[model samples]
Target chain A: EAGVAQSPRYKIIEKRQSVAFWCNPISGHATLYWYQQILGQGPKLLIQFQNNGVVDDSQLPKDRFSAERLKGVDSTLKIQPAKLEDSAVYLCASSLGSPLYGYTFGSGTRLTVV
Target chain B: GQQVMQIPQYQHVQEGEDFTTYCNSSTTLSNIQWYKQRPGGHPVFLIQLVKSGEVKKQKRLTFQFGEAKKNSSLHITATQTTDVGTYFCAGLKTGANNLFFGTGTRLTVIP
Candidate 1:
């Protein structure tokens, strides 16, 4: 079975610019998530969607970051007016559901905001 | 807000040596999942533990969940060059909807 897929493996942009990343989850998976990982740190959840509905996004910088999973299959995460601190890897992951099940991750998009 | 912390931010060992990483959660978890991410690669799921005190093994890797459901450990016996990567432990707190990932433990095995 194919794993989660992400686009534009690497990206570089100037601060204050906008950047977007796309994700295609595993077939039939019901949950999708976006996470940010700074160098040498674990992934920090940015948002989670279950069947097109947001499940959680408490850690997301709502003022600049937004995500959507329209129709529950593919997802997109966007950062507008990106800041220098947003120069981390953006990982997209999918799961069957809940913690009892493991998640499959996509090769993240490494964003560098100058 | 919850925090899951992993011990020994980094570990370097001989190819034949053993290594272990620990994870401690601020709150009880319903289940915990472990993943391994090789350099420049995405995280690959390793295992998940649900029952308190549960122990699971995969080849040379052994995973343990604490009796209190707030801690976990991953032990790799006779580490090999192929085992070099960052190991992460993520958990779903009893009432949370998303999994909280711990600071990863980066492993380097000298061949």
Candidate 2:
């Protein structure tokens, strides 16, 4: 089986500029998650989707960050007016919807805000 | 808000040495999962422990969940250069679907 796929392995944007990262989870996976990992830190959950419907977004910066998993297959995370603090690796993961089953993560998109 | 924390943010060891990382949560967890993220790569799931006092082993790695479900540990026997990476433990709260990840422990193995 193929692993989760992400595009634009790297991105650089100026402060206040906008950027978007795309992800395609494994086939047949109904639960998708977006995480942000800063250098030397663990990945933080940004948002979660269960088959196109949001299951959680409590940690997402609503004023700047937004994500959507359309058709319950692929997901896109957008950062509007990117800030220096937003420079981090964005990871996407998918699971079988049961905690018993672990998640499969993508290679991630490394974003740099200047 | 829930948080998980890991001790010894970084560790260095020679090949064939033993290494261990610990994870703790403020509150009890329903389940805990461990992951390894190689340098320049994404996190890969290593194992999951759900029951209290549960211990699982894979190859030279052993994972343990506390009886109180608020602490966990990962022990590696005879570490190898390939074991160099960041180890993270994520805990899920009761009735919650989201996971809270701990500050990872970065391991460097010198061969």
The recovered share of true contacts, given per candidate in order, is: 0.92, 0.78
Best by DockQ: 1
DockQ, all models: 0.86, 0.82
lDDT of 2 by residue, B11-86 (tens): 9999999999999999999999999999999989999999999999999999999999999999999999999999
Off by over 4 Å in 1: none
> Candidate 1 chain B: worst 10 consecutive residues by lDDT?
B92-101
Name the candidate that leads on lDDT: 2
Stretches of model 2 off by over 4 angstroms after superposition = none
Residue-wise lDDT of candidate 1 within A30-86, one digit each (tens)?
A: 999999999999999999999899999988999999999989999999999999999
Give the Cα RMSD of candidate 1. Answer: 0.9
What interface RMSD, in Å and to 1 decimal, does model 1 have?
Answer: 1.0
